[model samples]
Target: MIEMTRVSSPSDIIGIRDLQALNLKQNITAEEAIDQGFLTAAFTIEYLQEMNVASPSIIAKVGDKVVGYALVATKEIRNGHDLIEGLFDAIDKSAYKGKLLKDVNYVVVGQLCVAKEYRGQDLVQKLYGHFKDCLSKEYTYLITDIAQANTRSLKAHKKRGFQIINELVYGEVKWDIVLWDWNLTD
Candidate 1:
């Protein structure tokens, strides 16, 4: 009974936070990180609430339980957080196919995660497809960064049509900035 939809209620926000807690790099062990991928930044419900206000998240739910999510961070999020600002700064200096990314119309995937029980069910791709279906009209690309060591995430993004557009180090962690251009993918 899993369904794909936008974040529509306060509980969905908490669901995202709960799932994120289980998948963070520090929360998982090194072995699990290598095998399952990992998230770096830790965000509060307040921050997620703010981001959702500007752009609602794509989520996979079963009834009221959120099993997975792809959070969209529009330009309204820039300069409001330290780590995000660094990502934006790097994106501003980055180029894809000779055109600077800053000059392109895009939104960042603030965070993505699927509950452990929901993994291996093609839920990741399902969430991304929902992103395109809902956001492609307003945005040309969906952009985000994955830690270089988070190979699982990088491969998944590439498999989902995201291209590595740039790279940078923030908080001493090297990240691969990726983008899926809907104009090209759609």
Candidate 2:
């Protein structure tokens, strides 16, 4: 049976790293990346462990193997990431209606991915649903940035109820800062 839960053991973190390596932009072919989507950030074991301590990343596991993940991030964790730091600044200047995003209760979805074998099985959808159930009580909104060129991932997120709240270019890639407002749903 598949289980959806937060990272607990060191081996679970290692499983996440194993999945991340196969999906990272640098590790895959350009064609494959454009077709299957990719993870822009490469997280170290130390960082994953740190993130686990702050807010455990949610994962889908079958026995000992991690098949999918939705990385949960606190404000401190988001601010500390070099790639996501720019988003923190952009969101501080952006708002959901009248209030600044930074002015409200929120958390970031640092990165999300499913193992290649698990794709097309609705595991991504299940992971986000589980992620929301895990965090919606404490956070008013779930914010995440996706590479604009990644239509597959973007479509998946939008279908999950995330709306693009802002757009910012970081380096050559333009990112859409998407927000899933739990307040609106509540």
Candidate 3:
């Protein structure tokens, strides 16, 4: 059985890093990336450790083996990583430009990936759902940016109710800044 939960132990952190490495190396083709999703940027273990210390990431595991993960970050916690810090700054500027997302508490989905063997199993949605269940009360939105080339990730995120809130180009790559409002009142 697959279990989705927050990273809580050293083994969980290692598992996430291992799975991230595997996914990064496996999905090389554009078709493969579009079909299974791909992660371009890499994170050091030290960086992940700091992120977990601030806000634990979500992991999907089966029998003690991690198959997927979604890294988490708050506004204050993201400044430690240069790339993420830049992204947050761009997001802040874009948010200000639109005059939306004001005075709202939010969390960033820093990175998300699934192991090649686990791609079709819906682990991504499960991980995000569990993360939201654990954190939505404290955060008004779940935000992330997806590269324009990453169609699979963008489609899946949209299917899960995330909307494109802004667009920006950074590092020569176009990104869609997506958001999921957690505080929607029906």
Candidate 4:
């Protein structure tokens, strides 16, 4: 039985990191990435621990084994990481059209990955749904970027109600900045 829940222990952190490493290793080609969404950036144990400190990541577990994870990042937390900071800078100038992203109550899905066995099960939507359930009350939106080559991820996000708000080049890779707005009052 697969269960979706918040990260609650130290071992869950390690499992998240290990899943990330496995996804990175498999993300060498667009074809592979299309088959299964890939992670572009790597996160250290310390970084994961720190990010989780602010808001615990969502994890999918099956009988005590973690099969997937989605990391969360806030504005203050993004500032502590150079890569995330750069992404936010680009987002501020491009996605928000010169408006500061910090002005919005949003969260970044720093990374998301599901194990091979867990693919084709709608786990991505399940994870994002859990994220929304836990955060939408406090945040107006969720933001993240997918590599231009990652059509699978792009399509999945779109299917999940995320819109492509902007496009930018980072680390020499083209990215599609996506946003899922929870607040519809506007």
Task: Please report how far candidate 1 places residue 179 from its true position, in Å.
Answer: 1.0
CA lDDT of each prediction against the hidden true structure: 0.88, 0.89, 0.82, 0.84
Best by lDDT: 2
Of models 2 and 4, which has the larger lDDT? Answer: 2
How far residue 61's Cα lies from its native spot in candidate 1, in Å, is 0.6
Error of 3 at 107 (Å): 0.2
The sequence of per-residue lDDT tens digits that candidate 2 reaches over residues 1-186 is: 779999999999999999999899999999989999999988899888888999899999999999999988787776567876787788878898889887998888889999888889888889888888999889888888999999999999988899999999888889999998876652
Each candidate's number of clashing pairs is: 0, 0, 0, 0
Report per-prediction Cα RMSD to one decimal: 1.1, 1.3, 2.2, 2.5
Candidates 1 and 3, the one with greater TM-score: 1
Model 1 agreement with the true structure over 45-79: per-residue lDDT tens digits: 99989889998999999999999999888888876
Clash pairs, model 2 backbone: none
> How well is each residue in 112-175 modelled by candidate 3, as lDDT tens digits?
9888877788877888898889899888788899998888999889877888888878778799
How far residue 120's Cα lies from its native spot in candidate 1, in Å, is 0.8
- Model 4 per-residue lDDT tens digits across residues 7-92: 99999999998888888835456577667768878888998898999999999999778899888887767777777887777666
Compare candidates 3 and 4 on lDDT and give the better one.
Answer: 4
TM-score for predicted model 1 compared with the true structure: 0.96
